[model samples]
Target: MNTTPQQNTQDRPARLTVGVVGAGRVGPALAAALQLAGHRPVAVSGVSEASVRRAAALLPDVPLVTPAQVLKAADLVLLTVPDDALPALVEGLAETGAIRPGQLLVHTSGRYGTKVLDPALRAGALPLALHPAMTFTGTSVDVQRLAGCSFGVTAPEELRLAAEALVIEMGGEPEWIAEESRPLYHAALALGANHLVTLVAQSMELLRTAGVEAPDRMLGPLLGAALDNALRSGDAALTGPVARGDAGTVAVHVSELRKHAPEALPGYIAMARMTADRALAHGLLKPELAEDLLVVLADGANGTHGTDGADGTDGANGTDGAPR
Candidate 1:
């Protein structure tokens, strides 16, 4: 990742003095990214042991101070606190008269826009919402990942250029998001990224139950291709039993899930129903076959078609071994 320019560093002066109000995984990583772009990380605030370690490792030599002190010291302050804590934090900082005139106040909350920093703005702070659309590992690797990452940017119309420039300086692409659309924007990202982790974990657990030695190795290329196809083709990438309207296969899957992994059954049925709906709407599932598939899914939802108290060996070779 080409985070730093090839030009001589001794010539260009550092852009701004950066401070992190919360030394969580995202805070340090972002501060480190800004440091790579010729910004100085002067102060950070961390409470937990992990957060302190992250700050020490990522922002070496930077002083660990209070949140108020962070705002008092740095030109650019990153409010990387949890979503629920953001409002009170900003309000408290502004109430304490910590915000300086013309100071840059940036936050990394996906669910919020610049509106959350209204108090700071009133205190003469320039509010900017720059939420990076990537998971952070609280390591130097995250700084490199910022090179090609996309930042969901929300700021005042007058400060649009400044927000975009800051994102660019941190080696990120700026994606403009309206203030009113921030919640929906965050919901979309969470639905895809966060839920995908749960789905992958459930799949791995099911594979392990089915005697797969290395589930990650088994899912690596298959999931990679599936994700690539879904990204490239959208709804047209619908495949598997739901897309093919294989009601019998789906019924067997639900039965096996009920017998082997009852906890994962709900998610499997929910996702299958959703996939069926999309497949039907996208012309992927034939109308004639969809009726039976829908019935199978409805049965799965109602817990009526699966092996409730039977031997749990209905659609296999004597005993339940692996997915057929």
Candidate 2:
């Protein structure tokens, strides 16, 4: 791994003794990568059966010990605990006088930057946030998958070179994340990746309710294509009744969803309404068509606009039908 630019090629340490503070899904995978990079994974801390298994499998023979012992044994410590647990863990460790001056303390929480490690920093340990922008499965295979991922790095200006090198050695690119933007960056990822999973699962369940054979298999290509198109074409990839302004088809859709899958009806209507809004905003749907689609979605399968304007339910009697 490359060293700090301030250090001529020769002044840098050849390797660091790394301690893993938690052998969760992220910790062992990172330790394995650092091991492959020639760093020593000296010790790890874990309590759960799964955590123990993962550490043994990925960092074999690396001592599984108490958190204090792990900290004492290493020059670089990686804290991979849950986001909520980290601040307390650091503060507790620092309070016990486990953290030391000149040691590197790093955390892998996407939602936080080095600021959360204030306890360690106060104790004179250098702090760094090196969050890999990818999920982990707590397997050795995850180490291999790190090759193309971006790590959202937040480090003290003086310690940046060391942090970047560590990230690079673990087979990731370091994308500098400012301290204040960590939350927004993390939010975007959750909205896209996590929500996509929920949306897809909802679709799969709906297909099962429709009595489709092997619904997952059936959805694979269609969902894949839709995702690819959406990514490649942005708002232009929108399709279906909302985009086409087929109020009649959308009204029928609401009727069927309400009849067969009442749970999914609200979600369907919400998505349809949002899609129509986006389609209009992006100029993909003409104003007249957008108005009609919005009315139908707002009023539901009654096949009528609710009288009022955008809300369609402001106070309108449901007598006006969608434009024929």
Candidate 3:
């Protein structure tokens, strides 16, 4: 009787040797995850002090070598360099004749799809684009986070199964992204995840400046519930004064931010306008109330509050009028 591929694993080698080109926060964690999936990590290349430390911690005993050496040693080579450096690195590797035929060349860049690896593909290497949606701390914790993280995957049609299988082996869910859609997909993730960090940090700083102690503690539950609600019910989760079309409350907020956190005023006004538009589109903001709210936002945007004094200060409350 002929043995199936699954049963024939005992007769053939099972583990693919993994290599990392950049020992950045993302690379070593991924290599560690692959190690847990029974893959052998043979080599990693990183020049910085931080990279050396991370690689040692995450891939202990895996020899640190050059990028070309990494490609030479492993069956699956992870190109975990920065997005901007990826194209050049691939070209250089292909030019130097480092890439082997049948080698798996995987990159964890959200920006580019498989096209960036065409040079490597022309060298007879297989291309895989697998971008993890989660942030990394350059620690073992990243490995655990992979248990339910989503990976934005793009590959040649013939290699789709192979790409998804690699994602699953690293304990990630595979979310297929079209080659042409990679840029938009990456932009959406950056808009959400990256901007959320900025927003949260700004909110905490504003709270601190407003005489609040333990701002993190105060915002913890509030932000958590807000995030959960927004995730569960998108536009319907719009709340607060902007969503309710409370022109007076919004005006007061703009006045206070102008008085206290002038630097934050622009971002506040921009997000409020966006929120107001979304609320109007969702029918959450009443049309009758939207007119005044939009005017307030417009005034805020133009650095002309409805109640500004001659000094360009929001004179609704008497205080220093500095735009600083």
Worst 10 residues of 3 by lDDT: 315-324
**Total clashes, candidate 3?**
0
Stretches of model 2 off by over 4 angstroms after superposition: 1-14, 301-324
lDDT head-to-head 1 vs 2, winner:
1
Question: What are the C-alpha RMSDs, in order, of all predicted structures?
Answer: 3.7, 6.9, 6.2
Candidate 3 lDDT over 86-170, as tens digits, reads 9999999999999999999999999999999999999999999999999999999999999989999999999999999999988
> What lDDT score goes with residue 235 in model 1?
92
> Worst 10-residue stretch by lDDT in candidate 1?
315-324
lDDT of 3: 0.89
**Candidate 1 vs candidate 3, lDDT winner:** 3
Give candidate 1 regions above 4 Å deviation: 1-7, 306-324
Q: Which of candidates 2 and 3 reaches a greater lDDT? A: 3
Model 3 alpha-carbon miss at residue 47, Å: 0.8
* Tens-place lDDT digits, model 1, residues 156-199: 99999999999998899999999999999999999999999999
lDDT of 2 by residue, 1-324 (tens): 776432442354448899999999999899878877767789999999999999999999999999999999999999999999998999999999999999999999999999989989999999999999887888877988999789999999999999999999888999999999999999998988887888889888888887887988988988888889999999989876677666656666676677777787777887888888898889877898667667767677444433333344321223232221
Write out the backbone clash pairs for model 2: none
Name the TM-score of candidate 3: 0.91
- Give me the displacement of residue 20 in model 1, in angstroms: 0.4
